[model samples]
Every structure is written in C-alpha cells, then in structure tokens.
Target: MATTSFGAMRGLLNVKFFQTNFSAMEHRSDIKKDNKMKEFQRILKSLYENLIMLELYPRSQIDLQVFVLESDGSYKSAAFNAVSLALMNAGIAMKDYLVATTSGLINNVAVLDLIYTEEKKQNCEFVMACFSQSKNIAYLSLNCNKINAKDFKNLVEMSQGSCDQISQ
Candidate 1:
C-alpha cells in the first residue's frame, strides 16, 4: 500500500498487521495452514529484501501500513512519501529522507510531474530521486532524449524543490 500528501512525508506512516485468512474459516477447504505459512514466508522474504536496503540507514525496525489517499502523475513521489512517513511513525532513525519526482520534456517544454496525457506526448522522460535531508541526489535516469547540461540543471532544481516540499 502507498499514500500521498501535499505536505511533509512524516504524517502518513503507520504499521499494521491483518489476518489474510480471516474469511478462510468460512470456506474450510481454503483454510490450508501450509498455504498460509507459504504466504507468510513470501512476505518474510520481501521484508528481508527491504531490510537489506534499510540496513544502510539502520537504527530500528519499521512496521508500517499505508493507504493511498490520492493518485496523480507522481506515483513514485507518493510511494516515497508513504515509506518515509511509515518509518517516522514507527520511530525508525535514519540519516536522511528520500524523495522522488518524475519529469519530462513535452513539446520542448520541461514539465515536472507529467500527467499521463503529457507523458504520452513527451519525447523525453526522466525520474529524479533525491535525499532531502542531505540535499544530495541519489538517482537520475532519462528515458529517451539526452538532457544537456543546462536542462539537466533545471530538472535537478525542480526536483529538489519537489523533494524539499515532501521532506518539510
């Protein structure tokens, strides 16, 4: 699950556990204990993968549950917001907060958080991921057209502003 808000990322994180097989008892044939265990194992495996990433900023374990409040062109931003909020809600310590945004050049206009319609018309695409707390860029990728130095700088600035808004 994921969530999005216009403000800082600290407000959306929550952790929860739910019974996946809650209704299985009503359908006895579907309530296989082994199957449930397997599902749990898969979840654990995913958790392990996340843990490996979290280890880089280790402090505490995070258990969070998020729900999307809205959908827009910035799904990655929303997901990052959700994760950051979840960690904060769980009281996990970290060196920095990460934020992400998508951008593209459409009809020669550089646009931030391009909507689906804009993306369809765009000739170039990019996503910028940054660490807001540290003011450091973590990732940048261009999909089609090459961004020259000037345009790259503008994109970075725009993305940084988006990150600042998210981290605040």
Candidate 2:
C-alpha cells in the first residue's frame, strides 16, 4: 500500500468484474448498480468513477477486491492504498495517486499510524483516504467515545496530516 513496514498491519487488493442487469441500448445501469453495491465494494466504484476514464470503456464492468492479510490497525487506510496500486498495475487510467492513513486520540495524546493496541486504548479513532495530487478526500470514517469538540477538531486535523504524510 503506502508503506511497507514491520508493523503488523497487512493488506491485499484485487480487482473483479462489475455485474449489472441493464439493456445494452440503455447504457444507464452504472447509477443503479452503484445503489446496489456493498459499502466496501461501492468504495471501489467511487474511486473508479472519480479517477478512471470510464467513458473509454463504455458498458464495461470492473470490480476490485481488497483483503487484509493481517492487521494491527489502520486497515481501511491500507486497503485504499493497495487498491490504488492495483489499479496502476492493471494499466488503468487515473487522475492521480491515492493514499491514506489513520490516527487516534488516546489519553488526550494524538498518535499517527496507530497500531492495534494503541487503537484499543484510544478516546477516538480517525481514518481518511484522499488523492495524492488533488488532496481531496474520497472517504473518511471517524468514531468517538464522548470526545470533546476541541479534541474532535484536533483529531480531524491530525488525521488529515497523517493522510498527507502517507501520500508524500
């Protein structure tokens, strides 16, 4: 994905075919198909829509699958990065590189690229996925345990910074 580390987190990315039931003459199934995809699978569709030249392959189907070989924490971030690379390896067109990272606020202390143990101890958790060049978030998921407003703000900033660092 973004980085290879001795860190326990591990990820895998795979691509599969897209399936939809619409008349070839209609050519309007993409919208409907998206509505039916699972949240995780739908994420791949979003990335394809945002970055790929889908018009180049009209009526074509492309699907992506991501697996966590192992995990310590930040699995979502790793999965995003892995899929980006898989797209590149397939010679697919792209707007830019995609990268991601995770952060957690534990004991009022902010930590970057959290490990599983650290995540288990956190007051809040944050994850972000964004384009490296555009720096626009494709996805963000945050969970808090009664975290204060100020701390929540700081966590967002910290997560953004971590996401940027991975992109670089």
Candidate 3:
C-alpha cells in the first residue's frame, strides 16, 4: 500500500496477493504524515497466511506491487477490490473474494464508504477487509480520536452493509 501528499492533495493506495510462494510488502508515504506502512504489513501477513494457498508452490515469490495513483477517499478499500480482481485475473487461487471499505461512526450513526471530507469530520475511522463468503475479517484497521474501544466492534458491524456491496 502507499499514499502521496503534495501540499494539500493526499491519496491512499495498496496492492494484494494470490496463491504464490514469495510474499513481500512495501509502502511509501513521502509526506510522513500517516504511518500506513505499519497497517500495510499487518494486512500483508493476513492475506498471505489466511487466503493464499502457499503450499501449492515452493521456493517462489509472487511479488505484488501496490501503487497509489490518485485518491480522495478510502483508497485502501478500492485497492483491495482491485488486487483481488488482479489475483483472480492472474488465475491465482484464493479462499474467497475479499471486500473492504472505510467508514465512520459519526453523530452516533454509522456511515458507509466515506469520502475524505466525511472521514475527517468524524472522531474515528474504520477500515475493514473480509471474505465475501465467510464474512470473516481478514484485516481491520482503525484511526480514532476520543472514542471508545469497546464500541469498535459494533461500529464495524454497522458498516458491514457497505462492504457487502463491493464483495459482490
């Protein structure tokens, strides 16, 4: 995954995996404002271990390169959708389709796939990636300001309705 920032314009992006032998993740944020690299690594590990059928191939690496072009909203979610399709297109085996979305718990109401402006106005951000068939979370990331951790699960579930759309 990656993000670019120049003066005021900012973007977020990512790549994904398929059934392969080697796995590596790289993310660069020139602006150094948000540490998305850390989140990227976590997602990478989950994808590699949970979805990819690594046992099929040995001593090979499937170098997936993630790049950020332009983004005004939840690019990570878009990236996941793109990567999953790429993996499918490449004939890589996966357990299921992975769908993702970014939303916000604003004014006690959970919102769906939020844009940058809407995301910023809220006190928290929710990022989620899951299996379309299982509804199991393959990856989850959150950015919060003055919010309760206990409420995170419910908030995430509330936004699941949005993620379901992309999974299809």
Best by lDDT: 2
Runs off by more than 4 Å, candidate 1: 1-72
Which of 1 and 2 is ahead in TM-score?
A: 2
Q: Which residue pairs does candidate 1 place in steric collision? A: 13-85, 13-86, 14-65, 15-64, 15-65
Task: Kindly give the stretch of ten consecutive residues in candidate 3 with the minimal lDDT sum.
Answer: 17-26
Cα lDDT computed for each candidate against the true fold: 0.57, 0.67, 0.64
lDDT leaderboard ranking: 2, 3, 1
TM-score of each: 0.56, 0.69, 0.70
Per-residue lDDT tens digits for candidate 2, residues 14-116, read 3443333431222345667445335656666556566765444443555676654456667667777887888889987777877888887888987888887
RMSD of 2: 13.8
Candidate 1, residues 48-103, lDDT tens digits: the string is 23333443333333445433343434544555555656566766666665677888
Clashes in predicted model 1? 5
- Native-to-model Cα distance after best TM-score fit, residue 124 in candidate 2, in Å: 0.7
Clashing pairs in 3: 22-60, 22-61
